[model samples]
Target: MQGDQASVIGGAIEFIKEMQQLFHSLERKKKRRRSLSPTPSPKPPSLAAGELAAFCRSAAADVEAKISGSNVMLKTLSKRIPGQVVRIVAVLERQAFEILHLNISTVEDTVLYSFVIKIGLQCQLSVEELALEVQHSFSQESAF
Candidate 1:
């Protein structure tokens, strides 16, 4: 169990380091692109209020579904999961918009799409990892 904990901690630290490096690399690229482009880049279209609401609803439903299907989640956490997911999605959407605005001028459409997809996947994995960690912690406490 101690070994497992150490491995998990080490993996998380590595993940964080990699993410930091990625962000720094992206920042450098953004600066290079901005310097090369003299004209103002067109702003990426923001999601309409209705569209955002629809997205939130869909995300909440997904969370609810996962909670109902998963035995690992505590009852208390399950109740809050949908709301938390909506908030997480909202924040992610805002960050993605900012990233798009910053890089749209210089980055190819395919590259931007890939970047967004990667971020989304990473966020999902992070959330799942967190949930498992919480469940593990609670289970260990209950065993005491």
Candidate 2:
């Protein structure tokens, strides 16, 4: 009886040790995978307001404004604003442009993005058009 008890205890200790080793190995594998994965480069901040607006207008016209995200509140013509990154908060499709709202807040207001301006988290606009529009818009603002 004593010998049998000793064997059982030893087997239980061995099983516990094996489980600990297996857990350690799994943790090591996860760490290795995390280290080996490639890191993506950061995207440049979108500052070209005119190009963004034009891109919004043309792209909105092209796709018939079928987009989704934080922007969903600006359905009226008066609510639409150019030259800003309006994150789509919600969406409702119409014949022409998608009605969207944003998820941003200000000292006096809470604004919505109101369009498919940024497709899949990145705003789409051609570089040359963007540069030209930015210059023009800034000049216009300065003159005003």
Instruction: Say which candidate scores most in TM-score.
Output: 1
**Weakest lDDT window of 10 consecutive positions for candidate 2:** 71-80
Write the residue-wise lDDT of candidate 1 on 73-99 in tens digits. 111112223134234334445433212
Provide the overall lDDT of each model, using Cα atoms, as 2-decimal numbers: 0.31, 0.32
Q: Following a full C-alpha superposition, what root-mean-square deviation does model 1 have from the true structure?
A: 18.2
Residue-by-residue lDDT tens digits, candidate 2, 71-120? 21121111233433322222221112232223232211222222323333
Give the range of the ten consecutive residues with the poorest summed lDDT in model 1. 53-62
Cα error of candidate 2 at position 83, Å: 53
How big is the RMSD of model 2?
Answer: 22.0
Off by over 4 Å in 1: 37-144
